[model samples]
Target: MSEKALVHIIEDDAFLSKALSRLLGAAGYRTLVYGTANDFLTQLATLESGCILLDMNLPGINGMELHAQLRMQANRMPLIYLTGEGSIALSVQAIKNGAEDFLTKPVQKDALLNAIAHAFDQFQIDDLQHHRQQELKRRLGSLTVREKEVFDLLILGLLNKQIAYQLGNAERTVKAHRHSVMEKMCANSLAELVLMATELGLLDKTS
Candidate 1:
């Protein structure tokens, strides 16, 4: 995980955009600037995990519309909206639609920096959780047919003997499978295995 998250500034006002970039740069953040939404979208696929500072009023494809497109595509980058002549209704709508923060022009330096810090923190947390889920899926995929069966029953609160009886296997064989399940899943105990199963959505299906 990178300590300095990128701050993408999408504003048509060159002066404000430049000032924001300098401010963030001085605050130990990496930044990319775009004069329009289209400019930002051009490199969307290659953009790393970060947050966006979007200007509400742009020449074309405004901030709100771009945000809708980003959400539709499942983009996870947190966005903060900046507007010169913002309305209460617009602010409410932006927040309701998942904007990190909405700020009127002439935003205080502290407020802007605080919002950026908060957004970066959230992005890091979300990125970590996404990676954890991916790793769990990978571990689950490594299980064998028998090991998977044992794992399912184990998380369902089945004992080794009961699992062996249900699967028509010897108790010793079931025990071996159980051990393999614990090893392959990297689970420390039965409780942790159950928690992993729940996170992977297996518990609901089995229950």
Candidate 2:
């Protein structure tokens, strides 16, 4: 099976666009070309996973402007610039503005493939970290107001009797709620649960 990745080429030159598209397609990469910045933006909302190959110079809304637009929209898609010779300043600017890398035209097949691979590797790492943050938030949200209180106390090394006294609840009531808290948190051990609570800044105190 061909493990091809989708690549979006934002180039206006018909000859270069067709040639580049053919080169990438031959290398087992699914390719799409947009002739203008506006065209790319129109379809940006519908895109899921694809790295952008942008041209530095364009007729309306040039490459740098497009780069800023993507940032303003809070879209973190990987960008690789395709610029002409003597455009080092523009290439530097692209890197500062969050481009993964830029390729000078006429682009080399090996360099282009390597840049695409590197961009996707970074994209995967970013996706993983983003999901991990979401999961931590979900787990923390599982705690009830009262459960949070008991959890904080438990982390402080408070016995059930002390926790009951502190919260003005019976020792048996504290025990029941503690069990419920552990189950909701999916913590296998008291120490492990305490560590999770501490990492989340939910532990009121530690012994």
Candidate 3:
């Protein structure tokens, strides 16, 4: 788990929010408490990476509505729903909508901690993937226009001679461009280059 990972607690009940914060704090987890969905949205742009503990019933925008808004904005924060009135239908809907967990209030200590741990684990996985994607994008941006063209054709199973014929270049020039693509992409093999192309969604674009 990341040391800087925070848990955002958005609950209308001040007493419950404080109690939950204390519990999480005692367990060595950092928490930020918000009294309403609007309060949370105010800091949405600047919020740190972590999970959310959202109350089902809020003063203004309810939890489900807030969740929908986050989804629309493409926010991928892990969220756990806390409801005083447990409804199976609501729980099912939350899970289907990508909530990490749904728990009834006065949530069990073990259950809450476990859910938070799992959420943090998920956050780490997502954070790692996001970093890898950015790095791959950076590498791809380093390629010249001609090298990029060669990379695309090479991943599509084109031989050097075929790529040269398509681009009206000498076979040796195409081979040079292919070598540069392989080196710039830091791919050890043709299979690795294809995998990188897949990660960059180049295969989808070509298909």
Candidate 1 has an lDDT of 0.92
Taking the tens digit of each residue's C-alpha lDDT, what string does model 1 give over 1-207?
376778899999999999999999999899999999999998999987688999999988999999999999989899999999899999999999989899999999999999988987877788788889999999999999989999999999999999999999999999999999999899999999999999889999998
Candidate RMSDs in order: 2.4, 4.3, 1.9
Q: Which portions of model 1 miss their true places by more than 4 Å?
A: 1-4, 85-97
Output the lDDT of residue 13, model 3: 96
TM-score of each: 0.86, 0.73, 0.90
Report the lDDT tens digits of candidate 3 across residue range 1-207. Answer: 676568999999999999999999999889999999999999999998678999999988999999999999989899999999879999999999999999999899999999999988887888788888899999999999999999889999999999999999999999899989989899999999999889888899998
Which parts of model 3 are misplaced by more than 4 Å? none
- In lDDT terms, how accurate is model 2? 0.84
What lDDT is reached at residue 126 by model 1? 83
Name the better of 2 and 3 by TM-score.
3
